[model samples]
Target: MSLEGFLAASARGGAIPWSEELRAAREFGLSAREVEAAAFGAGLLPARYSRNAGTIGLAGQAVLHASCVAVAGCGGIGGHVIEQLARLGVGTIVAVDPDVFEESNLNRQILATVENLGLPKVEAAALRARAINPAVILRPLRARLDSRNAPSLLEGADVVADGLDTISARLELAGACARLGLPFVHAGVAGWYAQASTQAPGSSSLSDIYGHGTAPAERGVEAALGNPSFTPALAASLEAAEVCKLLLGLSGTLRGRLLHLDLLAMECAEFPI
Candidate 1:
């Protein structure tokens, strides 16, 4: 199948026929114009990218097309994180969340709406992400991350984006990714506070900075004090930016450091690992 054919099939809810493109792309390299034409036809690349389509050449296209990321939550931060990754041309995403959208989530959760109140968060997120870019392969898992499934979940992932709410799950995922040598991006939000960090293999992790697997203080405190919208958005955007940097192999990945933000105080700090 040609790249246009593959994209048309995807838009029609068919499998991504990789063999044809893989063979053709390897045998006779696709020109920048060809890639742009296919991407435009697939609705994957926007008009703005046309001017610089040659910039992300065949190698960059191959890397972006083959990379797969696992996102372990579908709440406020995770939903936005998924959106950003899709827009950035990540080819595949595994979205995991065991929770269902609730009335209370309307305040901050991006996938939460009155129509989707009873729907699973992961499912809603996948639907929205597919709507944005049908070419993206989204695997939505409606299960929580645990020791047994952690390895399988992290398998084949280039990076893991952390949006989990609980400390235990976060720690488990960090350890699992560490063992598998996959990089992980960590982000958390509660009340007027948010923090984010990237954990590369052989480097510090979320636990190293937050102490021994302690639950996010904001979760508990916010139950009594209430969560403000400012923190989640700020933290999620930073996390998304870090994910993009890592995917593009850019510098300043936030690795080995934590970015702390206090919305009420309008202050930000970076603590090294």
Candidate 2:
């Protein structure tokens, strides 16, 4: 079926009409039981969802229909960010990463399995995301994110999630989003230290905290020491949760503030932007 047809079917209580469902069952490789199960999934079927499913269901539906872009660095944080976004049902994802997997990635990178050792980070992440949700549309750009393509890639995105490492790149992306009137969530990880902030257009941004060119010495040291899955996992999950809240038009978004977490100190706090 066409992409529009698929989306239309997804809107009607998650079940396509009779002929489409039969065809999908036959040609798309989905089993009859799997089709039945999907039909009953809460976000797809209003009848199947309970009142409590409202939050997740509405969040999932909004994400399932919205288009989003993420500019990421190493697959550790980037991979986890994509995983959480896909599981939450974000429909369209554009992932930017130029790096390839290496032996050193096993400790934190989600796509860094031995089998995928030589693959491009974006490709590996796209593969994993598709495995989780076949219907998810992913545009994997295996290149560095710079000023030139940042705006184009992020254009029309309902929200932007940052898993980038470099301060320069982060500032450039944040500025680009600010110009485009997009909401952005910024996340950075180094060692057991991670920080995140959300910014709406015309609001405070990453540059506000990190400055235009000055990189934090502590953040550099943390990146040099490398990050553990434990930290990226925590940070990415929080970033994804905040993204979901923003997409669903929910209140209490982590806008205009920064949240800092230090695993060693077991301390987490929010500070003004």
Candidate 3:
């Protein structure tokens, strides 16, 4: 079938599930990417995200349909960030993680499940994103981000998300983004506290916030305070929102300012870098 024919058959004056479209695409020997382009070109999107059109609009939605985001670290914040990006109509997402799900990750990692306990975090992220939005292309990389390989992992991305755990790793990612001139959405969570910010090119560097080098500990206070499930989700959501804003050219972003959340005290504030 021609692209128009598939659109015509699939159209009900409303959006359809990506899985349904995928089925039709396969029957017609069409790739999901082709269907995605045709569907977006025809102003059709999954009904699940139709509500976002009011905020992002058709033009912004199209931008999202053509944008690519790279997410570093696929554990707590990384997993949830990838999830929101996929559901928000991001066309492509690259998830990088060198770890796997463990029993300890069950408390805060959204991608962690008993069934996938031993699975690579990136693989789980890919599966979850695809299940949520079949049109979303997830490139899962089972590798840690470092200066040598960060550029390659992050190449061709419009924006890179910093969901990494340690201050050192986050610093590495921010430096990489700076070098590559990519927008970096940074998020961190520990217990009831969470913070997020967007580091646009020439913006404040990560070192300004976390200092010059790696911490002596592998984890932070969160390891002692105990990270509940809600903290990572909350932090990731905030970071994801900044990414969407950057993609759509929205205003009131967290760029150059750190958004801090203290869930226990029910307080929210922003501090300039």
Candidate 4:
């Protein structure tokens, strides 16, 4: 069947299975992602994303598949963010992290398997994303984002997510995102507490949160307490949701505000940025 005809038929069923989508892509000489995009555009959700239909909507699914996100620091939070974005069907993910997985990362880093010790974090993220959803394209960049290379590294992304562990790198990336007019989703974790925010372009929230003048603290309390496996996933989920909301043009993103979660206390609160 023609691509349009196949999509239309799938629309009647309210979703298209991956096997059929793959067959159609092969038949039409298009990439699986391209076919999935067409399927959503034609008002059908790919079976892998079917459960997301009512919540995300068909048009939103297409939008997500067409959107690209750059995740700086694919370690603790970046690893989880990349995985969630891939499963959510975010089309292109730019996974950027200079370091590699090690024995220390097995504690909280999802992409860091014992088998992958010494593997580059970005490459590990790409591998996980593919395993989760091959239709989602992940571009792994094995480099750190300094002020000079931040823009070029994060170019073409609709939103940039901050998972960098250090304050300096986060500051540079936030500045770059602001210059590019891309919304920046940021989260910081230290011990049992984590805070997340969405900084819209032109906002100095990062500098405001981190402060002006000589770098406040090179690292947050996490440096002392260490990432204890739960905080990164908590903060990363919020960041991933923020990215998803931005890509789908949904309301209620944490723009101009910050969400603080205290896992130890089991309490969460939101504060204006």
- Please state every model's RMSD to the true fold in angstroms: 7.0, 5.5, 2.1, 1.5
Which runs in model 4 stand beyond 4 Å of their true positions? 9-12, 212-214
Off by over 4 Å in 1: 1-62, 212-220
Tens-place lDDT per residue, model 1, 1-273, is 766654454442222333433443454477433443465545554332333356564445446666888989988788888887776667789999999998888888777889999999988988988776555778999999876798887678888898787666787778777777889899877788888899997554767866655554423355565555566667778887787668779888899888888887989999887
- Writing each residue's lDDT as its tens digit, candidate 2 over 104-177 gives 88888787899988889888877887776655667788888776887776655788888876676777777877
Instruction: For candidate 3, write residues 4-90 as lDDT tens digits.
Output: 566656765567566667776877777776677777787776556678878887678889989999999998899999999998989
Q: Which residue pairs in model 4 clash with each other?
A: none
- What ranking of all candidate models by lDDT puts the best one first? 4, 3, 1, 2
Between candidates 1 and 4, the one scoring higher on TM-score is: 4
Report the Cα lDDT for residue 159, model 1.
87
How displaced is residue 100 in candidate 4, in Å? 0.8
Comparing 2 with 3 on TM-score, the higher-scoring candidate is: 3
Which residues of candidate 3, in runs, are more than 4 Å off?
Answer: 16-20, 212-219
lDDT at 150, model 3: 78
**lDDT values of the candidates?**
0.73, 0.70, 0.84, 0.87
lDDT score at residue 203, model 1, on the 0-100 scale: 57
Task: Please provide TM-scores, in order, for all candidate models, with all chains considered together.
Answer: 0.78, 0.79, 0.92, 0.95
Error of 1 at 239 (Å): 1.3
C-alpha positional error of residue 57 in candidate 4 after TM-score superposition, expressed in Å? 0.7
Model 1 lowest lDDT segment of ten = 12-21
> Candidate 3, after superposition: displacement of residue 226 in Å?
2.5
lDDT of 4 by residue, 1-273 (tens): 779787767553677877888778878899888888778666678888878877887788888899999998998899999989999889999989999898999999999998999899988888798888989999999998877887788879999998899998888888878888989999999999999999999787888788665668889788888879999999999998899998877899999898889988999998887
At residue 66, candidate 1 shows an lDDT of: 64
